[model samples]
Target chain A: MSLSDAPGPRWRPAPLLPRDEEREVSLHFVVAVLCFLACLMAVGGVSADRAARGWARDLRGEATIQVRPRLGETGDEAAARAAEAVAGVRGVTEAAALEKQKAEALLEPWLGKAVLQDLPIPHLVTVRLDRAHPATATDLKKALDRAGVDADVDDHARWLKDVERSAGVVRWAVAILFSLTAAAAAAVIAFATRAGMAARRDVVEVLHLTGAKDAFIANLFQLRFARLAAVSGVFGAGAAAAVTALIELVGGGQGFTPALPLTWMDLLTVSPCPLVAATVAALSARLTTLRLLRGTL
Target chain B: MSRQPTPRAAAAYGAEEAFDPTTGPVVRFQNVGMRYGRAPEVLKDVGFTLPVGSFHFLTGPSGAGKSSLLKLIYLANRASRGTVQLFGHDVERVARADLPYLRRRIGVVFQEYRLLDHLPAFDNVALPLRIAGRKPQTYRDDIAELLTWVGLGHKMQAMPATLSGGEKQRLAIARAVVTQPELLLADEPTGNIDPEMSLKILRLFVELNRMGTTVLIATHDQDLVGRAGMPVLHLNEGRLSRKATRRAPEPAAPDYGPELGPEYEPEPDEPELGYDLGDEEGEA
Candidate 1:
């Protein structure tokens, strides 16, 4: 009789592997953690590199002159003289004297605002060296001495080197963190896939005897893991993003923002984290299952 | 390429006709040997041929490799030595992609029933059809009727754990035959059922054999083998011996005791018992 003639209950076979609710939830948690760590590392690395470059660009080919108030000269008068002397130098491009208020503000972080007004703060002059005829700190100091200005020349080379080195170390640390997180994630998935295969060995044998192709059986696992990774990766990335946004929000009020501001592009770079995670999970599952099936079945 | 036999072709080729080996045996093995990893060979120098549309019983002791021999026949295990062939194709030479199709033509009823516990009886029996990519709407009625014929009509929605041993065996048998495979292999199919149910299950195999499907049953049940009166392939300590054919007795009417209720019918139509070959041809 034709099937249409019999109105029976319609049914579909349960998948060879059940949803594995507990295992999957645990896997999601792991993948999410890995994704969060990887994304945070990536953001941290990019921000550090940008900050280093900004600091270098700001300090490169520049020198600062500090003129103390003489016995009878006011601080402003000495700063004016130092600025004029530095600007007159052959290799100097421009020189600007810091006002009393600006100088006080620079010291505000170390000393209280009102108290800094009573102290004898050195008047500061910033000198930009000409690119075509760069001047050394020694040459600038000698030129200032010859101009009868009592000032000290600082090239900021030591500070710039330290900043760049620290930034490099931070970048490397971030990269190492990323690598470790990825490795840990892969290891976790591989272990879980192996456990899953062991748990479902009987099912695998039955499917094999019943004519299921290796690819079909592998896909059943690969697809599930890929989906899990993708979903968890998103959750982890989202959590990381929220945490970063909070840092930015909290740090903004205190005027302690990073040298290079975080941009939407930074977040966009981390957006593909989920896809990468899914790919890694799928490949790991596929390879593991195929190898196991070949050896055992 | 060899084409799968259509329903019309199957109808034309009666099961009672003797198989002509000259055309080639449906299954052939030469000096086949098998072992698990570094373990000793469980099956050694086993040679046999199962002709098209033939029925035979494999009899052996518990450790005599009956299941192992069946595994070799169904492509579940490869022989360490010698060659094996199924359906005119060298098993080793068959492309991996083509293995599934080859497997689709062979149905196996495992000893444990191996029903997915999460699925109901209806879904369990429909597994072969689903593996063959047949949609539910197309085979729903056929499956329901097959279950009903196996006396499992009322237990269609019951889980494997809920079904009795006889019911599970019946479900497994129904699953094996649902695809109407060209070859049906059963490993101790009647091991757990009562004598009456065993006879009934044997009749189902007989009906399937009449429809041009080769049947091989691996079991140690001598009474069942003797009652069926088919040729027997005996295995002892990895060695095989063939028993000469015996004249088959006429099938007696099954006595459905009062407990069986009206569910036990006298007989089902032969055409209904046979799979609609149209589905096979459609697959082509």
Candidate 2:
């Protein structure tokens, strides 16, 4: 008879961490996974929110100043006229020539405060428009050309677009990573349960012959694995939470750091990770048992 | 159930008087053949009808497919060739999900005793009842009484790995009969036990049969088969040869009898089931 015809006993391999092994990890692993997921979800939400809010603020209160040179006027003279004309424009809230000092302050965070003291900075104007939405840079530039100004608009829309798209990419990437990890965890647990079943094959065969149904046999392993996955999940999530908490605590004490801070909402998002881990365990155990039983006893 | 060629041939072969004439048989195998994957035929053109409540011995040497035949009866393996009707139902055509329900109606004892080492004697004996979804409170008294009858009243809590050879055999028997199965299939149950224990177990089998449970035992013990006086379904090299008018041997053991005292001793730690007969008055 072929090997398939005389199918081996309905036993699969045991999990890497059997019940008698270091069971603590298995128990806590589920919770730990939840924590990790919660953190990732929270951070993504917060980062996206912050970027979007910053873009909204810039869009609401900002305007562009442009200059166009008349046939004989110097670029400097045109720049001066554009600034003066912007200052005179109706409903212009605060039209200040953007000083080298203010520009240097923006660069201070990146290039250090002292580096800008020796450099020649660009001459620009910062305008707070009173209208509901900012005017398009193109419209503002055309208006400035009619006014004999030789400068162009800078509304920072392109910069905002880049920021928003990058945040979106990160959110999607995190989602993909979460799904893949959960699948991997399921695969690992399934294989382990299969092995455990194989090792205890005689037990299964005897049970079957003596009237144990396949469901009853499968239920036993399912419960055990779900319990194990829950524990492991808790451990993994707890570890992640602790690490994130430490980083946040350190950053908070060091000053207004540029790093993303963990909010209660972020931590809360990962709360379901443990439950998902348990689900993974149960699904893996169930699928493995079903497949193996189908092939064997 | 139609006029199949194989079944007709098998019935005409050597099983004419193999079945009992008193009542309908519990298991009827007509032209059964089984083969493992791609292997040459193991059991071929086999047919036997085990009458209800009849005690019979199936004799064959090692690897003569004795276990394979028993497997078919127990629904462990399906026949590749013909029909096996169990408890009046065609097994080959039955639904796979229906096997568990049918299996609960049968009991089996393996050559190795196949006891779960982790569970104690009580749990092992109670397994069949448990699998049938009997509540612990519902079947507790029945299981207790059966264990006591099997002379394992005191060893209920003892693990199989620690039990003596004879004790293990009795435990296996108790588990098999706990559910009051309609049919019992034993493979070399007496192979590892002492002659005295063998006779005791044989008497147990006869008692079960008399209680309306059909029993089929596969053994190489000539004397045990002769003592039972049951028809011998002799199998050799995949061919069955029926022995005509097999005679019953004398009840008493002859020269090779181990000098076990006639008196039954109650081991000190044995729990009291209150059946302390001084000795077996006579051999069966």
Candidate 3:
């Protein structure tokens, strides 16, 4: 009879770590919470970035002309002349004089509607520039001066710069948050591995005495943690996605449109969070097991 | 069989003369001393040579460092102070990667019977072969045959916790000898078994020794030692001494009697028989 025809022994090494149901549940909960927070931070950072870009794009070629009432000229007349002057500029596409009430309404939120009418608000002339042929703020101001209108030209560049700076800070914060979460998860897995090794010291010693290699023992732990991390990551990602969808729905119900609308693709970005968590867990477990084995044996 | 030159014999000829490897001992310890970290030495100035294919019993009371000596021979414990040579190569000089290869040639039945409680009797016996990277199918029949010879065939599927103390001891012996190691170091092989089972286990070791595997069994059972009629290496308070020999007439055959049955024949092609086993005149 050949060796292949003989019956084989049916025995496998029991898992080095006993399955602690409570501990497993707690770990999953912790990992899921971290993952959710990370996903939310990612989404918030990306949305802020898109909003800042949109604001920059819309304000790029636009300027406003504010006219003051001269001694003999009415505010309306000055604004009309300024608008006409802006229209004749090289790259100005359309210029219109703002109505007195509409101009006062712009300040209504800060100054109160009752106080706005009595104040001598500047007559505002809004100008839209042809994006293909942009006009400089200096040229527009020079044109307004020649038209006998005393007006100040504002290009909204300072506001856009502030927005971009805020967006950059948010992005950095989000990245830091993601890194801290990953590190925390890895720490948890490493601690768990150490405890498992201590608990299974007898089994490990026997295996070692029996000539089992360090790599063989480490692989068992690494694979277990990786699987647990993956499952927890998925649950965490799902919860975060649900929370984001709820926020979008509520915001939409309040007649608010997001700066950039949420799409299926935006939600799909959270899918990789679990994979990242799993990698961290596996690496942590492997390193911890090897280090412990080296020290003990 | 030829014997290796002992340290005393070598010293008489002066240290300058080198020993030949072809006829050297299977294990040699020269002034070996061992201690745990920061602890007093457990074994001191231990020096001996187990010539190739010899059988000896290590006898001492509890805490006499019999186990520690076995550890030294099996490469589990490195001597704190002296040189240990196994298979004619210095253990201290052997690389860490090569230690496992050296350990494979030595089989040890631990005093505690260290069987995996989770594994069945058959798998426990098959452990050494498995560790040696033999496919299970390749060693299945051999494991079954060995387990049966140890009288554990009925308990082949039994877990260690379910087995009796005697069965556990037998299983451990089975595991140790499964790979047919060149040197077998059994720490108290018959300590927990009945006299009948003890004799059977000793016979198994005797049969293994006859097949050219060197055997060293450490036990405090002086009766068992006396019955075996082999050379005794006595350890007292961490000191070792070789007791005088008592030779008996060689038996024509090892008549284990009708109790063992005809199936218990030692393989005829075994290279050498270490000793002849004869029935005691008044035993039956």
Candidate 4:
């Protein structure tokens, strides 16, 4: 007797690829860890980048001058005169003479206390420039010459350039690190896809002989891996965000020391981790599957 | 060096909508040979023609290259040398993009009964339609009815892993005919089933052939081949030798369908829909 008389509830096609493979779980863990590392790198890269910019900004707005004594004057008198000369110049926000004690304190970190008293010190003048229209070295020098002060006006141009260069290096390093992590994630996904295809040759062979296009077969793997990577991305991104939050919470007002200032906004950047992971997985799986089909199926 | 596209290929590519190719033999092989990468040829100097809608049994010993021959017909593997033509288009010369178009017209049942283990019997049978880009609702009833017709109606929701050897074989058969392809090729299709089910499966192929679907079965069952009384293309040691069939010869097939090759005869472009041929009436 025939048994198909009454059709059951509306039927839907099951997943083309098996869902409960043990390797898939392993793949998820590996991909999720990669995503977590990538997310952390992203956070660190941005924080370090911001810190570098802040240091460069500080250097750009300041200048220091070393004042030498004239035949009739003491070092202190010459330094005060130099400071007054610089303060009158255009774009000079403020200028002040540095006391010997303050200068010795600044040098204490590098030079030991034993050599400090015996050495003849040149009086110093500190200058703060208008950030929008900062005074140049030439302007400061012209003022010093006009005031008849024997001084070497250092506009901090050399230090500022070095700081800017360091910032550029940090930017590029972060960029390269980010790219390598993404590439690693993609390679891992490609490897997993290859193994998955090999394990399911029966399914692939049947689909191929049944007139499925290479794209049709590839799409199955692409979607499967993409979903796996997306969930992995979520866990990774969430962990990264939590770590960032904890550092920000315990990191005083400046965050994990003044060097890396982690703000709450950094958490928002990791939100796209899941999306990026999905994209990479989808692309890697599709390419691997098409290549396999072309070469074998 | 330059390459020239044949008139049929040009028509197939340029004016697909209006290109109704003139049909002759459904399959033609001339001095065909096949081999794996740098390996010796498994099929050598094979030559034959399968007229449209003709039924034949390809009987051979274990390493006789029966599966390899079907592989050439289905576009799974290319012929090493000489010509293998299908629907009047040369298999080797056809563009890669157009291979799927040709493959859609041919259905295969492997000796392994290569059903997707992840899918239920109903979805497994519905695979060809889904691959052809049909919606679920349109083919839902037909697929349910097809599963019922294959004695798998009650097993529609069951996975291939949960089924017995014979049940899986029947499910494979239902999937093979779901598209009602122009040509059906089987490699020991009844290898896993009982004699009764084997006869029933043979009857299924016979009925499909009568409806203008060409059939080629690769089998070791001499009794089934004898009972069917179809012409036998006997293969031994990578060579083919033909045997006369007891049944009267039918006329050559009419003109081949458009899109290169779909239905040899365009009656419904569908299967024996709800034909109630589920129970065997001793057609084999």
Candidate 5:
């Protein structure tokens, strides 16, 4: 609490303590670390989801054409026929098909040890569109079905939907992390304010006997804690920025380069986390101090 | 303005203005009653008013409501069924914001000294000024001189727990008078001190009164009161009475001067101690 009575001339006011109180510092450090980790996870998940959504947007309304396993016993002629069949199909302007080996490699990332490589993975053809050839995905699928080859058309929309839903979970986790940081700040502020109140019990009584109103007394503590929280918050935010920078710098050259670095704008958005934490601390301290002072002194 | 103090008028209009603006009593009480919660009353029909700038002794047995009455005057407790005006404003009607100013004008010496045990005597004395927002640097010299006057100059840096009872009482008095408040209330201020110290304290009150501060001392020590030749308000079983004022007899001077010692011998003019309430009639 500010000692408002002290004349300004001779009084050298002490700044209220920052979060550097050993316990407070440690607590902030923990919250900072948690926030940092959460930010990284959130940023990473967001990047992956963005990339997936981009792929989905590009693939929507398109069908892939694959031609292989013709009834006749030659693969090359079947591939040649597959190209012609797709070009002639309504709604298909062009076709660039996947080589069999390439499809096996795509499956290799998840399926493992494919003995079927020699047996021929299917020849997958992706059909491109000419803007005015008005044929729906259903019409294309029916055309591929009539072809002698075991051909299939994939719209890719359902796959995108699944990826989008999974990304939603990551976003939810980020939201929860934000809430947890706030709750932690409030808890720490309450604990610290209570300790301060206990230590200053006699001082409080003297103030009361001197006819100080409860609001005046409560304001002193509230303002003190506000200063403490603000200072801590500024430092915490600075530290978070520094750590996030280091993370981006170090995580940059690694194999797991964050799918994409958080843009300057995104980083700027996160910059206020420390301020929010501090505000939570200040408000919690004020509320706790007022509540306990009301009940006791 | 020249009217003699009426206990009722004094209570209705506080003691601060009861005296002639030039020469009236400083405090007056009339039918002042106090109770705690739903329990029975602690003080009943208390009535008296001290003359302007006069020193008086309040004597009653333990539990006789002496402290409660002092509390009412000091604005610590309110009267349950009567008015207690201070400086001419009814205390009950006084704004909360203004209470501090009123309290600031009245000095109180508690029996316990109520020293902020953590602070040294110098700081303790400076508390009033500090709370009032006076800079420590500004009042530091004034406090030092007062502490020295009370013979506590050497112990200025000492804590309350370390000081002897006499030293503590002196410190309490120094704190009470530092502001030169209009009224001073002492509740057995000398209870823990030696007779020599008691007389020294009594002399301090007399000196303060001479300087025009109104003082009311509550103590059961009749010998102390009689020797001082001050009027006494004796309280018994929730009732109050005023004993006649008598002048000291042709006297031998009691040496109450500053010699640090244990016993205080009475002057020949001093009346015999006669305020034993234990032998009084049954309580009402």
Candidate 6:
């Protein structure tokens, strides 16, 4: 850093603007908190989406059929015929007639065995659909109609619709949370820029009247706040990621809860947080500085 | 950045010759009026001209608007009314983007020695050149030479807070002249310094003036004005008039304090007063 070095040392000019240290630290804290909340929102959104899809998948894979005996056939024979028809359909992976024993088991809790034996129980069939291209309700109806078996099919479409709607709502809430966090960060940066200008008005005045360009003075605050925001963003993202990892570690395979699961891959989503924070800070600082300079001059 | 040096020519208000910078004044003010943001005018109907290489002392009491007039020269404030022409370009017509370039051609040494506290003495001195976009390698030696000339070579690395008042004043001077501006304006350059330092600053201005930079110093020190032996543009209560001659015993101007010990005196052969200051002083 001395002048006597080999080639005259490059004159690294000192920073033209100074940040009041206490306010800068407080600003860092506010921005870091916003970033952490944003990361949590992002991770929560993804997990909720996965949970909804899982519920829908379970509902889609299984369908139940209620069978009424034909005039000449017994209830068991009718149920077996229905299963055979469904098994021959294109998307049915497996189908079987529900035996009387399993049917009794399903009804025993609601009705005492003595009353169940006296009552005539309905015969039933269970069908498994291929997950990738499950059969639609219309397809199942058409197949039953072709077999001439008197039966009603229930594909759990109502439950699937409700799950999808809940997932959509979660998606919207996460987007709003993320947007609010970004806006709060921008506001903090703008406030810091204004405070910085107030703290060093004399320096700005001298630089302006001394023929320094407006861009030169503005660049000073922009770079300073940008660097600060980037560091804050790193801390925020790191803390969020670490907390998520801890949850995953404690909860084993199905993390935290089945409804909202955390996975190792979700941490990658937070990697760009620091860069986003820095960009927002730079833009906020630049606009604030230009407005102040133009207004004051 | 200043307009080319024009021929030493004179023009008065409403003069009917085609205006030419190649032959016009370095600065021309015609019926100029200035005020700060809707306030009452502080300067009114002022007119003057400084030709190339002229040095003048602007002397008045504290409320005489001396600083306001200097602001108009340095492009810190625009005239509220009338014409202000600097280096032959009408300031009103200059675009906002061009104002900084125009200011680059003029150097200002502030009353407060507005050196930034964070910068070392050398960086402070090198600011103007840096703002003008000169490379550090090109101006580094020149800065050292200028600092050495101003008695600051040994303190080049010292922060501004560490320097004494006189040292700060001289450091401010070095910053102002690092770019070798065509015009130099100083506001109360001697107020906070000792008498010896005051004389040293006066000599620096004289030397800068000799090097063809037009110089204007606003001060309350009667001794500095008398010792420099330059024409005085006396401003009083929003009005301006020139003394035009330096012969001592200025009847038209305010009393130069009898305390200005025997260094300057009235000359018997000098006329009563050369300025058209009229019967106001006659009554006095």
Which number leads on DockQ?
Answer: 4
* Every candidate's lDDT: 0.76, 0.67, 0.75, 0.80, 0.65, 0.79
Q: Rank the candidates by TM-score, best first.
A: 4, 6, 3, 1, 2, 5
In the predicted model 3, the residue pairs found to clash are none
The DockQ values of the predictions, listed in order, are: 0.23, 0.18, 0.18, 0.39, 0.13, 0.28
- TM-scores of the candidates in the order shown: 0.75, 0.74, 0.78, 0.86, 0.64, 0.84
Residue-level lDDT of model 5, residues A129-171, one tens digit each, is 6545545567666665666566666666578677667667756
- RMSD (Cα, Å) for all candidates, in order, is 9.2, 11.5, 7.5, 7.9, 9.5, 6.6
**Rank order by lDDT, top first?**
4, 6, 1, 3, 2, 5
Q: Give one digit per residue, the lDDT tens place, for model 5 in B23-88.
A: 433455667788988878888877666655666677889988888888888877778987665655
Fnat, model by model in order, equals: 0.36, 0.30, 0.11, 0.53, 0.16, 0.32
Off by over 4 Å in 6: A1-8, A57-64, A69-77, A96-126, B1-24, B243-284
- For model 4 the local lDDT of residue A287 reads 99
Tens-digit lDDT track for model 6 on B1-284? 33432232222222333444333456788888998888889888888877667777787788788999998988878899978888776777765656676688789999889999988888888788777777778888777777877777778889999999989999998898877788899998888788766776676777776676777888898767765566677888777854543434344433333322223333333222223232222111
lDDT of 3 by residue, B1-284 (tens): 01233444333433332545434477777788899898999887877777666778888789889999998887667899987877776777755545555677778899999887777788777766666667766777887777778888777778899989989999999988887888899999998999888889988888788777888999988766655666777777777754433233335324444323232333445223222112111211
Winning model by lDDT: 4
Candidate 2, residues A38-87: lDDT per residue as tens digits?
Answer: 54555555645565555656665676554445689754565567767676
Model 3 over residues A1-297: C-alpha lDDT tens digits?
A: 223322345634334444667777888888888888888877776766677676766687688888886899898998889999889889889899999888877889899988876787878999998887878899899998887778899988798688778768877887888799889999999998888788777666666666556776788789988989999989989988887787677767332255644544457768898899899999999999998877642
DockQ metric, candidate 2: 0.18
Chain B TM for prediction 6: 0.80
How good is chain A of candidate 6, measured by TM-score? 0.87
Q: How big an interface RMSD has model 1?
A: 4.2
Please name the candidate that would achieve the greatest TM-score relative to the true structure. Answer: 4
Candidate 3 off by > 4 Å: A1-26, A47-63, A67-97, A125-150, A253-263, B1-26, B94-98, B122-145, B210-212, B243-284
Which residue pairs in candidate 4 have backbone atoms (N, alpha carbon, C) closer than 3 angstroms, thus clashing? none
lDDT per residue (tens digit) for residues A1-297 in model 1: 323323445555556565778898999998999999899888878877887877776677688999876799888988888888778777788999999889888899999977887887878998998866767888878877887888888898888899889888988898888888888888788888889988877767767777777887898888878888999999988988887777666667432265645655576657888998998889889888888877743
Task: Kindly report which residue stretches of model 1 are placed more than 4 angstroms away from their true locations once superposed.
Answer: A1-13, A60-94, A98-124, A128-165, A253-273, B1-22, B37-40, B93-98, B134-137, B248-284
